[model samples]
Target: MNEQQFSKSMTYAPGLPEGATFYSAHKKRVTSHAVANAVEAALKERGVTIEDIAEIVLDLQKPFMSGLTIETCAENVRGVLAKRELQHAILVGIELDRLAEKKMLSEPLQSLVDQDEGLFGVDETIALGAVSSFGSIAATTFGYLDKVKPKIIGRLDLEKEGKVNTFLDDLIASIAADASSRLAHRVRDEEEKRLSQNNGK
Candidate 1:
């Protein structure tokens, strides 16, 4: 189908409930298709692609799921949040946007995000949040990242210093992943409602 048809189809999704427009107008509601689109757009804006993100997330999902004991991850995440990294997060985002404008990530940027280096954890968090779009998981994960990234920066070289274990990173990363998944589900629900309402009109 053409882009116009695709956009129209999205506006009138099946099984949408009443009162869904509030979510859409406020941009709080999201559909899976929308998530897909948002992810694509954000990547393109960065001169990166879905493959780049998918590669990182896929690497994360397995070890991130297995070895990261919940408590440890939470504690590590808490440590990151304690440092006050909101401005830092924004600065990093701007830097990334610049890199996109330049059509490539620097070698430093590549190592940090692609390799998931300890120094660039907050950057990773924001990127995940943006592309995930309107998912509760994304919101909450980004919220957590936004809330505590500076602390993580302050606590860098944690593994080298033996201050952290796999468990800690795992928990924080898991928090992000779970939050995004949940966000996707909620967005879909609200989106269905919005689309149904529009159809009823």
Candidate 2:
């Protein structure tokens, strides 16, 4: 069959889109929900409860917007997770953490993961990529969260018997920071909308 005919004959699935050829048609793309699920599972494995995540969400939102509900905080998290680049970063960071925990990396790399080396900044660097989604505030928020290590983050940072959360800790902090930035932007948008309506009236 001709290339054009082959392309025209391709059928795409719900979440998959057809490409110029049939080989690319069945390729599966990662969705935001999948990224969120991976994050949630990692948190759960580390004993982070849903309530703990909710508390972080609330803490991040309360300072920027008054009377914001937990539901809204969750929605912000979902929105932040939906970004494709952010998802890639989270997955990659988490996978590195897992590989480190398993001692699957090279000698120096494995040692850094095992010892939680002070000079090893690679994990933090990976997490930093996610901060740009929400602007400078996200970076500031991440710094704060990293310093304070509140809620489950504190738990992750604390040395445990058999667990290494070096990367997970940073990943979680970035997520919270991103969520906080999202909430702040959304709150500002709503305030602007209200003011616009009042001026119209």
Candidate 3:
């Protein structure tokens, strides 16, 4: 199809108004802030607020970084959520859980997601894949949180009120893990700079 036809056929371009011109629709720029807000809204609708995830981030870094504030943790969490890849992960995982809740997925697959089958590792797989860009520290942190299921992660996993959070719990863990990794590296960079300056002086 020609570019015009292709653009016209696109009815669901993100951050674009309905029936927008082909040029406007195709050329529309999706800002990081918009994606982050959408992801945060999805989490809030699922009863998982930014603050809820930030608490996990705070707990993860507080011991290692003294005087780490919840606001800083929350900012890092927002930074992680703003990433395009991570945003994609959160939307996909949450949509799957939502579909499972509505019994929309096919059998066997439906049962796996709905029951959060222990053998079904795809949930963690997606979560880890999204955060892998952050490096090994983020991946290890994710594994630790997945195993421990701390705070909100633990509560989400235990939910049995017809809520399917198989992927969500892992996704949240990955976000918090990534945020912790970012904070750690940033602090380490600052410390290294300070040490270098002191030595020079």
By lDDT: ranked, best first: 3, 2, 1
lDDT of 1: 0.40
Per-residue C-alpha lDDT of model 3 across residues 136-181, encoded as one tens digit per residue: 9999999999999999999999999899999999999999999999
Error of model 3, residue 190, in angstroms = 0.8
Off by over 4 Å in 3: 1-31
Error of 1 at 152 (Å): 4.9
lDDT of 2 at 87: 72
lDDT per residue, candidate 2, 11-65, as tens digits? 4433333332234334334445555676667667766555665578798778766
- Model 2 spans > 4 angstroms off: 1-36, 49-51
Score residue 158 of candidate 3 by CA lDDT: 97
Q: Locate the minimum summed-lDDT window of 10 residues in model 2.
A: 13-22
Best by lDDT: 3
- Name the candidate that leads on TM-score: 3
State each candidate's clash count.
Answer: 16, 0, 0
Worst 10 residues of 3 by lDDT: 17-26
Show the lowest summed lDDT stretch of 10 residues, model 1: 161-170
For residues 133-183, what per-residue lDDT tens digits would candidate 1 score against the true structure?
325644555445434533332233143421222122332333344433543
Prediction 3 global C-alpha lDDT: 0.88
Candidate models: Cα lDDT each? 0.40, 0.75, 0.88
